[model samples]
Target: MSIIRSERRNRYTTISNTVFTNNQLSFQAMGMLSYILSKPDNWSVSPAQLITVTKNTAKKTARDGVYAILKELKDTGFVGIEKLSTGDTNYIVYDTPIAKKPNPYNTDMGDPNTAKPDPYKPDPSEPTLIKTDIKQELKSNNKDLLSSKHDDTNPSDKNSDSAKQVIQHLNAVTGSKFQCCKSNINHINGRLNDGYTVEDLCLVITQKQIEWGSDGKMAQYIRPSTLFKASKFSGYLQAAKITKLNPDNRPVTLADFDDLTWGKDLGL
Candidate 1:
């Protein structure tokens, strides 16, 4: 499905909020997403938007200060970032480096296929580089099959089943018409413009419970009615954005987040 652009841009605010809490990001990260969501969508918004927004709410210069926040937000799974080719000369070549994922159990760094370690190895030293690489490889393999029996870190595929579940949950939760400071309820239709079912929406709430936070604070950011002033419901994760769909062939012209709310004393 194609992205529900322009007309359906506000519901993402609530989606990002729930995503932030369930994923364990700092309030600063959450605040940044809240700000990005408030801006207008035009292909993409740059770091300049982040810098301006952060500096405004927080008294510090956001120029140098935006990256760490961006990284944290990225790490916490609050935002989906894509490296689009900007025609500007300075930026034309900037997206060259793709973040490499760890390779298979094979630990040969020189080989094109082996998994590189997390945080790529810098220009290596002259001494024993090959030996060190082998040792690290052996250790990594053994740690999984033999050495450490207790593996708490999830070894799940990031974009796999559970991840899809997480996405569905997000899509379901944000599939509501944000009660913005206007009387037009057209955006709050009973059927989700983004195509979320009631069951799918509840699963997100369940998933949120599975993921805990360090702060232990209850989530207040997703209350759409409570936050009807700044932005209304934006569309959910448009599958075109996440799925590998051919842009020219996608079905939905726009997947909307408006009209996703479950009202009080309604819908048992």
Candidate 2:
């Protein structure tokens, strides 16, 4: 029986076309939101807990500041909160696609009886190497069954061409001009974090696709959601901007990004 592990987090929804989500939040707001969302699943935290403990735990920001931070996250739709009858509010955490899996639960070397036919029998002259022994140690016995699923029986199929086009596009935005080849698709996939969509990557080069390479035009492969993520990584805010100002409702700017210690670490 196959056993899927219990998930630590769950993504209720994903944001696509986040181009509209720019500069909507301040850095402090972003950090607070990240903290809230990153908590382990099943561990629902209350606002009082946050107001008292979390507020001054890592960053001696403030008790009231947590409220403001949560408010900011809610505005962006990154996280939501609920008010309990106990008057203790709780943060609503969403799952991201980038969750990790535990190590292989089991493994099998191989079954010799299932070796190739006499004409193409396993090479009795040599031993198998450790690295190439099993693609997935856990499911080694079903190797052939697994490979048959993705078998490219026809290289000239229309579907095949479309798939190749997508790969080329992925290569470009990944800073891979001509690197990740068809055989390395899994490797590339492994590196992509959840929450990233092909459209997201395309946005990173959408302008470039329009612009000329030495050739003339480059294609875009990133999805809208992924692009928004990149926008965030690039210091671009989602439509959820929080100027990071105080309750005074003052305006915050890029200049004050690192100036204030609102969310500075208190060394635990």
Candidate 3:
């Protein structure tokens, strides 16, 4: 590869070369970190504003995309996010990536799959237990099969009403304008046919809204194609179940973030 280098005499920003070599950082994360470092100290910009300025280089820039890049930098110790008392967030860029604390989880524990399994010795008294478990599983499967038949036999009018209710709940929580159109109704009906109740779909909507509503970047994903996706709906429904079990775990208000503790731990 041929390379050209330009020598700058003035109006330049100085940054560490380690950023370019860091395997932990993505190209987007590195570039965004460099851009933030180039700005004068105390220069503040929100993710939404940063998206506007980065349009030429990143045609698909959005609040969520910008937040992701910034998050990457923060995770790698190149930046820190501080939510100020004034309700504005501040990004603190490091000249060099900060040293990360040692991860206890990274320590090699012998491979789990290599561990020997316990020798199975059949318990004479356990036949009843095994039969009971098998009967319970079969009973559950039969119930599901019967429910699927019931759904298939339900009138179209009833299904339409159910779909409308689900969409109405989604719209109410996410501030979306989705209608009970054919496409949206089909998505809802598919989940319903899978033995999920309208309440289950509404629970998924409410749980996701609580998670993504205030998050500008994630807010855009609260749509029919994503929420009611066959591959994703079950996982979302499972999360909703978890949230319901611990209702108090929900975030009720905005709180300041602790980068040293939380940022590095954030998953991509």
Candidate 4:
């Protein structure tokens, strides 16, 4: 239920441009894009879920058609695809501008039905030139500026390390191995930003492990995606507190009864 806010202006521009100018996308692709944009931000949906939700509305029945649309969106930079550890794909559609190559054929000075410009034809206008050193300096300055912007947007090393620590703690407490990947770190950081402390997260993990560790059926469900989710973290914290006060016998081991023997040792 983690929702990322979508930019209204960017969404409108992307949809409008795709419908009116792109002319390459099919009706199915356009419909799929529209459907994805209509979803809440940061909403992760598998391909099967997407097909089920969009098939009726898009009037497309084939799963392959839906997959083709998704692939097109990914290739065209309209959406991002994250493959989860569970062998399912998560699609993230953003309201950002997609990069496109400049079309020399679609120029303001040309008619749609007219032929393309001749390579040998000389233009009547005079050409203006810039000095080489100034151009090089400008290019270097632009590169430096872009680098700074990229650094500002990327997650810092401290945040990444903190996320890794959380993953390690979970692995230790639950006796399960989980790697710290970008998607996992992103989820953990997002929960942290939402006011959940690292202590609260670890408490939840330990509590769940104690409760479900002994049960073979529930042990498989102990994963980062389930225990560290944004929407469910608060609930888990509350449950953990309740379980702590009552104390479940499921966590008990044979070591707890090593002192006890037969009736003779029990003062019989």
How do the predictions measure up, each by TM-score? Answer: 0.27, 0.25, 0.37, 0.34
lDDT score of residue 209 within candidate 4: 63
Candidate 4 backbone clash number: 1
Candidate 4, 12-89: lDDT as tens digits: 533456443366566766776776666566544434334334323335333344555666666566666554453223
Number of colliding residue pairs in each model: 10, 27, 1, 1
Model 3 stretches with alpha carbons more than 4 Å out: 56-58, 100-268
* lDDT of every predicted structure (CA atoms): 0.32, 0.36, 0.59, 0.52
The parts of candidate 1 lying over 4 Å away from their true place are 1-13, 20-23, 40-43, 56-58, 85-268
Model 3 per-residue lDDT tens digits across residues 218-268: 878888778999999999989877876683443111111111223323321
Ranking by lDDT: 3, 4, 2, 1
Model 4 lDDT at residue 232: 89
Top TM-score hit: 3
Greater-lDDT candidate between 1 and 4: 4
- What's the true lDDT of residue 13 in model 1? 35
Q: Write the per-residue lDDT of candidate 2 for residues 120-212, one digit (tens) a residue.
A: 122567532222111122132222122224444355443333233334443322323332234433323322443433333223332322222
Candidate 1 matches the true fold with a TM-score of 0.27
Candidate 2: Cα lDDT at 43: 55
Higher-scoring candidate on lDDT, 1 or 3: 3
| TM-score, prediction 2 | 0.25
Model 2 residue runs over 4 Å out of place are 1-21, 51-59, 85-87, 95-268
